[model samples]
Target chain A: MKLWVSPRAPSPRRVLMFIAEKGIGDVELASVEIGRGEHRSAAYLARSPLGKVPVLELPDGRALGETRAICSYLEGRHPEPNLMGIGFEEHAFIEAADRRVEFYLLGTIANWIRHGHPGLAPLEQPQFPDFSAAQGRKLREVAGWLDGELQRQDWVAGKRFTIADITAFCALEFARGLMKFRPADEGFEALQAWRDRIAARPSAKAGA
Target chain B: MKLWVSPRAPSPRRVLMFIAEKGIGDVELASVEIGRGEHRSAAYLARSPLGKVPVLELPDGRALGETRAICSYLEGRHPEPNLMGIGFEEHAFIEAADRRVEFYLLGTIANWIRHGHPGLAPLEQPQFPDFSAAQGRKLREVAGWLDGELQRQDWVAGKRFTIADITAFCALEFARGLMKFRPADEGFEALQAWRDRIAARPSAKAGA
Candidate 1:
C-alpha cells in the first residue's frame, strides 16, 4: 500500500502517527504538495475524490480516504498494541471517546485555523474572523472539558492510551503550530501535562 | 440497553434509522426533549458530556455516546443485517465513504443551518451569515459530487447499501427538511433518485 500524505496537515499526521505507533513496515509514503495543488490534480483526485491527503492506495489500486478510516484499516491489518479496543463493548466506548475529541476539539480547531489564519486564505476562501472567533471559544471550552477528563483518568479514552489520544494530541499540536494555542496558558494543567507526556513518545516525532 | 433520543434532531434520527434497519428490538427508547433543554440537564450531561442525543446506555448503566459509536455497538451485538462490513478492507472503504458524506455533506449542512437560520440563534450564538453562505456553497459542491457518484453506482459506498447510505440519506433528508434542498430541483437526478429510494425504506420513517 502507498499512503499519500501531506505531513504538514493534521489529518495526514494523525495517520502517520498511527502507523508509527503500530510500527507498520509494509506501507510506502508518497507526498502530495498541497501548495503546488498536487492533491487537486486529476491523478490524485482519482485516488481521493475529495482531494484530501493521507489516502491509502491498496495493492489492487483502490484507495481508502479519511484519516479515521485509514487508521481503522491499519488497526485491522496490524492488531498488535491495539489502539482502538479489543471487544465489541470496548470498541464502542473507545470510538465514542475518539469521536468526541475529533468532532469537538480537532474539528473546532480546523474551523478556527481555516477561517482565522491568513495563511489558509487560499484554501478557505473569504475567511470569516467572527466565525473563527466563535470556533476558537468552542475549542477552549472543549480543551477545558478535556482537562477535566484528564484530571480523572490517565488517557483520553479511559485506562489505555488508545486512538483517542492520537486524535486529541494531533489536534492540540495543530493548534500549537498554527494558532499558537497552549492549554497551560489557559490554566488547563492536566491537559497540558497530558500533551507533554504524549510529546515525549517516539510516535509523536513521526513526520515532524 | 436504553437508547436516549430526541427524534427532532438529525443525529438521533441517524441512530433511530439504524435501529430500524437492523431489526433490533431489545433496546428501549427514552426521549429527551431538546426544546425543553432536557438534553442540557445534569442527568443528560452525565450520560453525554457533549449533551448530544441518541446515547446508548448499556445494561450496566455505562453510556455510549456518539451516533456512529452507538450504531457500531448495535452492529456488533446484532450482526445479521451487517450495516458496517464483514472484514477489514470493507470496513475501511465503507467507513471512508461514510466519513466523506458525513464531514462534507452533513457537517456542512449543519453549519449552514445553525448559522443562517434565525431559530437556531439560541443554540448557535453570534450567527455568521457569510460563513453560513460559504457552507451552503460547499454543500452544493458536495451534493453534486455525490450525484456523480450515484450516477456510476447503485449505492453511496459501492454495490451494497451499507451504513454509508444511511449517513448520506440522513444528511440529504436533513437538508431537505431544513434548507429546503431538493437535489432534483438542481438537476441532480441521480442523487434525487437515490434519496427517493432510501426515503421509501421503512427505516426512513423510524423517527419522522
Candidate 2:
C-alpha cells in the first residue's frame, strides 16, 4: 500500500500518526507538495477527486481518501491496538467523542485558520472576505470549549486514548502555529498536561 | 436505548431513518425542542456538553451525541443490515464518501441555510451579514457537485446503499426548503431518479 501525503498538512499527519502508533510497516509514503498545487494534478485527482492529500492507495489499486475514514480502516484491519474501541458502548463513546472533536473543535480551528491566516485566505475563497477578525473569534471560542472539555476528562474521549485524542491533539498542535495558547486560561491545566503526554508519544514525534 | 431527538431538525432525522432502516426495535424516542432552545437545558447539557440534539442515551445512562456517531453505534450493534459497509475496504469506501458528503456538501448547505435563512440566524451567531448571496452561491456550488457525482454511480459509495447516501440524501432534501432543484441542470437525470428512489424508502417517509 502507498500513502499519498503532504508533510505539513494536519489531515495527513493524523493518518501518519495512526500508522506509527499501530506499527504498520508495509506502507510506502508518496509525498505531494501542496504549495506547488501537486494535489490538483491529474494524477492525484484520479486518486482523490477532492484534490486533498492523505489518499491511501491499496495494493489492489483502490484509493481511499479522508483522514478519519483511513484511520477507521486501519483500526479495523489491525485490531490488536484498538483505536476505535472494542464493544458497542465503548464504540459509541469513542465515536461520539471523535465526532465532537472533528465537528466542534477541528471544524472551528479549520474555519479560523482558513479565515484568519493571511496565507490561507486565497485557498478558502469568497465566503471569508476579512479573515482576520472572524478567524480570531472562532479560534478563541473553540479553544475555550476544548480547554473546558479537557479539564473534565483524562483524555479527549475520557480515560482511554482513542481517535478523539488523535484528532484533538493534531488540531490543537496545528493551531499553535496560527493561534497562541492562553496559558492562564481557566481549566487548562489538564489540557496542558494532556498535550505534553500526547506530544511525547513515539508515534507523534516520528510522524511529525 | 432512548434517542433524544428534535422534530424539524435534519440531524435527528438521520438517526430516525437509520433506526427504521435497520428494523431495530425497543428503542424509545425522547423529543427535544430546538425551537424552544431545550437542547441547551442543563439536563441536556449533561448528556452532551456540546448541547446538540440527536443524542442516543444508552440503557446504562451514558449518552452518545453526534448523528454519525450514534448511527455508527447502531450499525455496529445491529450488524445484520449494515448501514456502514461490509469488511475493511467497503467500510473505508463508505466512510470516505460519508465524510465527503458531510464536510463538503452538507457543510456548505448548512452554512448557506444557517447564514442565509433569517429563521436560523439566532441558532448560531449570524456572522455573515449578507445572507442571500452567500447562501445562493454555496447552494449552486454544492448542488452542482452532487449532481455530477450522482451521475456516475448507482449509490454515493458505489453499488451498495450506505450511510453516505443517507447523509447526502438528507442534506439534499433539507436544502429543498431553501433551494429549488433545477431539473434542467445537465447530468442530473440519475440524481433525480436516485432522489425519488430514496424518498420511496419507508425509512425516508417515516423520518419525514
Candidate 3:
C-alpha cells in the first residue's frame, strides 16, 4: 500500500506521527502539494472525492481518506504497541476522548485559521473575523478544560498514551500555525508539560 | 449498561437508531433533558466531562460519551449484523465515507442551526449569521454531491447498509428540524429516497 500525503498539513502529520510510533514500515509515500493545487487534480480527486491530502491507497487501487480511519486501518494491520487501547471499554472510552478533542478543539483551530488568517483567504472565501473570534473563545475554553484533565492524567485518555494523546498533540501543534502560544500565561501549565513530553518523542519529529 | 440521551438531538438519535438497527435489547435508557440543562448537572458531568448526551454507562459504572464511540462499543460487544465493516480495508474505506459526510455535510448543517437558529443562541454565543450563510451554501453543495452518490449506491458507504448511512440519516432529519425541506424541489430525489428507506426501518422510530 502507498499513501498520498501533504506533510505540512496537520491531518497528514497525525497519521505520519502515528506510523512512526507504531514502527510501521513498507508503506510508500507520494507527496501532494496543496499550495500548488496538486490535491485538486482530477486524478487525486478520483482517489479522494473531497480532494484532501493523506489518502492511503490499497494494492487493489482503492484509497482511504480521513486521518482517524487511516490510523485505525494501521491499528488493524499492525496490532503492536497499540495506540488505540487494550480492553473493549478502554478502546471505546479512548475513542470518545479522542473525538471530543478532534471535533471541538481541532475544529475550533480550523475556524480560527479559515476565518481569521489572511493567508487562508484564498481557501476560505469571504472570511468572517467575528465568527473566528467566537471560535477563538471556544479554543481557550476548551484549552482550560483540557488543562484540568492534563493535571490529573499522564495521557489524555487514561493511564497510558493512546490515540487521544496523539490527536490532542497534533491539534495543539497545528494551533501554532494560527498563533504563537504561551501555555503558562494561558494557565495551561499541565498542557504545556504534556506537550513538551510528547515533543521529545522520536515520533514527533517524523513529519515529512 | 445504561444510556443518557436526548432523543430530540441528532447525536443521541444516531446511537438510539443504531441500537434499534442492531436489535440491541438489554441496554437501558435514562433520558437527559437538554432543554432543561440537565446535561450540565454535576452528576452528568462526572460521566461525560463534555456534558453531552448518548453516554453509555458500563456495568462497572464507567461511562463513555460520543455517539460514534458508543455505537462502536455496541458493535464490539455484539458483532452481529457487521455494521462497521467486513475487513480491515473495508472498515477504513467505510469510515472515510462516514467522516466525509460527518465532517462536511453534518457539520455544515450544524453550523446553520447553531449560528442561524434562534433557539441555539444561548448554546452558541455571539452567533454569526454571515458564517451561517456560508455554511448553508456548503450544506446545499454537499447535498448535491450526496444526491449523486445516493443514486449510485444502495447505502451511503457502499453495497451494504452501514454506520455511514445511519449518520447521514440523522443529519438529514436534524436539518428538517432546523428548516422545512422539499427534497424533490431541491433536486435531492436520491437523498429523499434514501431517507425514506432508512425511515421505514423499525430502528428509525427508536429515537425516544
List CA RMSD, all candidates: 0.9, 2.2, 1.5
Listed in order, the DockQ scores are 0.89, 0.63, 0.78
Docking class of 3: medium
lDDT score for residue B179 of model 1:
80
Residue-by-residue lDDT tens digits, candidate 3, B1-208: 9998885788988898888888989999999988788888999999988787889999888888899899879988988888888777787878888898888888989998889889888767788988888888888888998998989989999899999998998888888877665456698999998989888988888773
Off by over 4 Å in 3: none
TM-score per candidate: 0.98, 0.93, 0.96
Cα lDDT for residue A92, candidate 2? 73
CA shift of A178, model 2, Å = 2.2
What lDDT is reached at residue B181 by model 2? 44
**Residue-level lDDT tens digits of model 2 in B93-187:** 89999999888877877877776677776675744746335656756665666667878878888888888888888887777756554434544
- Writing each residue's lDDT as its tens digit, candidate 2 over A123-161 gives 566546443356556666666677787788788888878
Over the stretch A74-138, how does candidate 3's per-residue lDDT look in tens digits? 99999899998776667788888899889888888888877888877876888999988878888
Give one digit per residue, the lDDT tens place, for model 1 in A56-172: 998898889999999999999999899998988899899999999999999999999999998888788889999899899999889989999999999999999999999999999
Which regions in candidate 2 have their CA more than 4 angstroms from the true location? A127-135, A182-187, B129-139, B181-187
State the iRMSD of every prediction, in order shown: 0.7, 2.3, 1.2
lDDT of 1 at B116: 95
